[model samples]
Target: MIGTSISRWSMTYFAMALAWLLAALVMMVAGIGYPAADLATPNTLVLVHVVCIGWLSLAMCGALFQFVPVLVAKPLFSEKWELPALALLSAGLVLLLAGFLSLGGRLPPALWLLPLGAVMLVGGFGLVVVDLGLTAWLRPAGPARFVLVGLASLCATAAFGAVFAFALAGCAGSAGEVILAEGIPLHAVAGLGGWLTLTAMGVSYRLLAMFMLSPDVDDQQSRWTLAAGAFAVAVTVAGGALAVGFASGLNVVLSISAILGLASAVLYGRDISGMFRLRKRRHLELNMRMATLSFASLAGTGLLGIALVSIDAFTEQIGAFAFLAIFGWLSGLVLAKLYKIVAFLTWLETYGPVMGRAPTPRVQDLVAEGRATKWFVIYYAAVWIGTVTLLIAEPNTFRIAAVAMIVGVVGIAREIVRIRRLADVAGPQRLPIGTVMPHLLYANP
Candidate 1:
């Protein structure tokens, strides 16, 4: 038997995340956010939070709920909490988005929703942290340690985010002002660099090796990457807090943290490259091929970030850097991985029980990679063009690129839907579940 039952809520989370991503793409194509306007504006904030929380965070959580058990060879501590967490997160995100819309001159009284939503989001993620933390504690694998660190960073990120929301609501007075000015950078760094990036790195270490049929990669370079990443996050958070609190030596502290972060990026890249070289699989799949672009984007983003900070050009380039990091690197990786993961999980759920009793198709049979590869190419190419145009201050060109990205996202979304509905073509008898209900709608497949 599989080590644990598939996470009942995983597909729901994936569906919701993809929906949010599509919405964000539409908004981008409409020129409602960055590259067309100021990055710090309310609309931009709405777009950022929508993508970060609704899309990326939800996807990551769902993956953990499924994969953590696999990694540990133990069932989740409790599957019961999964749906409630998802509910809370979804409701909170809607409220938060509404609050952002209000700040952009919608319902002014709805401003209070910001903190309210933040609290609920924190509560939701807190439950996930508890469940995953306990699971990791029981297993205590090396990768699990990185996950634990990532979960800790997520808590900090949420807490800081809530405070930032309060600051936005004018509830924190002078301290809020200081936090708004000095703490935002730390908040971004911790959430993006520490929480998201570290977790992705940790998960990728396991996934890349497994998918590529590589030798176990729990080596010195991987350890150093994890340690350096953790250290960089620690310094950034502690140094940022102290600088904000004491109002002294902020620049120096930030500089050191940035340097450490860059070092970690280099180590991580080198480690992943080593894994690729050691892989027994000579033919790389589309997912792995696209994943390479994400890795390259990470390296490029790191170099740009370090350069911008060194020359004090951060303010000017922060918009472009965030674009490259979030959309180009992180989002690209998520989408690419999903192409394989969703298919694998779907196959497992649908076919695992009947494998020996009946002839069944392979997991790779579920996805038509030849068709899917085009969408990946379009997505990455558009992202590349969009990033370049944005960096060059070419709004019109960026808007055109954003439209291409929207088309690519729509295409990928269609492909995912098609995969989920494969039971129709494979014949209803092949489905483990009796009904023809949407795969993502039910807790059970």
Candidate 2:
């Protein structure tokens, strides 16, 4: 039995998120965003929000809507409401991009769009937080604990983002200027560190174990890792507030948060490694294998961040760090898992009802991992190439690498859509052409 109910809206969210990702990638190819333009410019801001809010945030929230119920063993407070939240988020993102364009002279001065879009975003996020937050709180066990902290971080991220919007719109006067100057880092910290990274970790903890047939990550270790991460986000948000409000003690608080965050990363690395070492499955699947690459990228982000901060060159190197964090670590991990998640969910939805009376394909039968693996390899390789090119100030090389990345994304997208359509699975062969063979006609892997 598929133990948890399927989230009807999740696939819709994933589709929109992937569309945004493709749009952003196209922008990269056209040299419209960062690495192509100045980092703080309006064009770059547009691209950043496209990737962050439209793609990453949507995808993560969608996954949470589906999985949080599984983790907490409860139905969503209201599954019907998720579609409205997605709509609000989508509309808000459009307005946010329009506001950014207005600043770039691409749109006629719609400065009000900044706060207006932010308000919509806040509402969208608030709905999600309330729904999932209530569920996680009702049953704070295992990954649910990590998810709860992550939801809190989402609130902080949205709040900071809203303040930034109002400030940039010139509503807060000098205070607005101060927030723009000092709060950007905090906004990033809460959004990336707390909402995205922490939540990804929490979700992955349960997912990796389930997919690999491994024992859950040790409860004690999981607690320590998430606790430290949660505290780091808490401190970072606190630091942002002080900086915005009192303009004092911000640095000290950030330093402490940095230490806590590093500790969390270290502990998390240890825990995940142990999970791999102890797994009952001797041969890891493609998604797990791809996740290893993302985990490596995360470690690289940590090392690079430390090196930059220690030398006080973090500001100069911020673009490269953001690139690695967004594309390599976050995007890579999400795409890798979606390959499995979409298929698994499809299998459950399609086959779970008649599991025993009629023959049904294995979830693996829904995927063609060998074909998809090369796309993953291409994507990650392109990400590194793009990251290095950006670090070295080689925009031309980065653009070329972006083209390669597009090709990779398109290939992966095709595979995902094929699975969704059930385009390949049929007949007495039992499995799809790309899957295992009992019949003489199936393709060899």
Clashes of each: 0, 0
Whole-model Cα lDDT per candidate?
0.83, 0.86
- Against the true structure, whose lDDT is highest? 2
Q: How would you encode candidate 2's per-residue C-alpha lDDT over 1-445 as one tens digit per residue?
A: 2767878788878888989998999999898978889988999999999999888999998889889998888898888788899989999999989999998999999999999999999999999999999989989988889888888899988887888888889987897778788887788889888999999999999898889888998899899999999889988887657766887747787888889998998999999999999999989999999999999999998998899999998889889999999999999999998888887877776666567756777888878888999999999999999989988889999999999898888888899888876666767534433333221111111
Report lDDT (Cα) of residue 74, candidate 1. 84
lDDT tens per residue, model 1, 192-216:
8888998898888888888999876
Models 1 onward score TM values of 0.94, 0.94
Error of 2 at 80 (Å): 1.0
Following a full C-alpha superposition, what root-mean-square deviation does model 1 have from the true structure? 2.2
**For model 1, what is the alpha-carbon lDDT of residue 424?**
28
Output candidate 2 Cα RMSD.
4.7
